[model samples]
Target: MNPFRTQRPARRGGRLLALAAATVAALAPALTAGQAAAAGPAPVPALDVTSYLGTWNQLAAVPAPFNLECARDTQANYTLDPQGNVAVFNRCTTWDGGSNEIRGTARIIDQVSKAQLRVEFPNVPFQEDPAGTPNYIVTALGPDYSWAVVTDPSRLSGFVLSRTPALDDASWDQVRGAIEAAGQSPCVYLTSPTTGGIDTIAPLCTR
Candidate 1:
């Protein structure tokens, strides 16, 4: 046996290392940690809120740095897919006011609670190699389920998605009241930018 024959194994190890690095590079976007723990448990809304399902227009949200790239009119449409998961179609106007869409799948972490769900975009990447979690809990449902206040414990991301683009004056007050009761500062909410940069602000709920 030649003294340098062992070097052959070393070359193979290098190749394996390169492949592993490549695999990790491809999965960086899908990986997230400490997300599950941040959300805690989904709170039960006081009213029968199930009727709130359907297409919801993003009328307003917190102006966070992460979502700055999303233009006004950013909306999410949730539908049931054949695979028994929630199909999420998120559309937002680009900075230049052009339409952009990201299709994703949402799986309920706990079906019975129907509170927390993981949303993954570009489902194909997940099939190849599921990595970190991108989306996490930010808010919980109100008793009526007519509206929900999603927020992460860190309070970095929050959404006030409703069943319709505009809640009636009475309903609007109820949403604000509920959010306040939950101990969140309502001032953080800003109207979602729409076409032509219109802010459809809702008056604070009186309830």
Candidate 2:
């Protein structure tokens, strides 16, 4: 009956569509922030490779199938080879009181920070690609080279290493923060066995 009556429905539909668009626009920043957070934080800018050399005890790690054989007392020893590659020696006590050791090679992939490395072990097929993943990133380090935190880009693997078998509560807290900053939940990591020392057997450490 009114001239604007016919236009009412069309105007209502237009208003609904405008509201929807405004809602999406309002959520755009939040959605983008969530995506960025999910992408994870970047790796540390620099690493002192010389001070990082020597022995490190595995204080904690995200469980991986490759390391399932290790029951406790997990440790890694790194030394520079003549050709500038890093000699990697990893050892852990098995469930049957025996020891398991693996020797590998680590090549520095990032020359600037030397924090990124590609590790390869002959006969061990962990990665499908022969070139390996350049995900081994050193995310954090202790003030005196007493502890370090390593993680990959996927956040699937992480390791807390210490110069000694045990770390102070403050250091552990720092490690937890670092792990979280790397976009990983610290609760996902299992405390590695170090009660029996670096190479000793302790079945309880497995839990």
Candidate 3:
């Protein structure tokens, strides 16, 4: 299950709570960020799919029902298949200390930038793209490709991924800045658990 579906996430503690000077939202809706717009940036112009293919740590994300059972260690791995399509493999650990996974295929829609892609899972039933929406958009990426910010065309979901489980203060700042630059709210995302992970599900926004 992808982490970008519709669902409200609960909070977590530690530095997140300490840094989260803003009060908690008593009830966050399924869609917490700004609606999609034609303006702002996404589909970064210089995404090298070759450099992007590999494992990425799901540091934070918008809560989704499809990921409800996932407790920790959420991540995604991408590989290029013989047909030149990106293979999508997502996995997470369950609360009962189990594991869950789903495999899918992604077709690059933006041939030029290769930042926008339509992903579909086998027997997953999310493929009826009547609206012709792009499911995966690489909105932002670190200069060194150390981190990335991903969301859908509609901005319905958001994810902050990194090469490692935990990010430094500078990287976190960069991630939040990237989200804002992409015309999306960082609050829409909550930290995911990982090895040396944040250990909290708190919103990324402080204000």
Number of the predicted model whose TM-score against the real structure is largest: 3
Estimate TM-scores for all models. Answer: 0.59, 0.74, 0.82
Backbone clash count, each prediction separately: 18, 0, 0
lDDT (Cα atoms) of all candidates against the true structure: 0.50, 0.67, 0.74
Predicted candidate 1 versus true structure: per-residue lDDT over 1-207, tens digit per residue: 000111122343344335434433443333223332234324442322235446666655544433444546777777778887777777775455555566677766544445555666653332332543324352445344555676543444457776555666666566666555444444545556554434543222211
Better-scoring candidate (lDDT), 2 or 3: 3
Residue-level lDDT tens digits of model 3 in 20-112: 333225323423434433463568897899999999989987765566666678899999999999998898876667677888888888888
How does candidate 2 score on lDDT? Answer: 0.67
Error of 2 at 115 (Å): 0.4
Error of 3 at 36 (Å): 6.3
- The worst-scoring run of ten residues by lDDT in candidate 1 lies at 1-10
Off by over 4 Å in 2: 1-36, 128-132, 196-207
Candidate 3 displacement at residue 51 in angstroms: 0.4
- Give a tens-digit lDDT track for model 2, residues 91-119: 87655556778787788888887888887
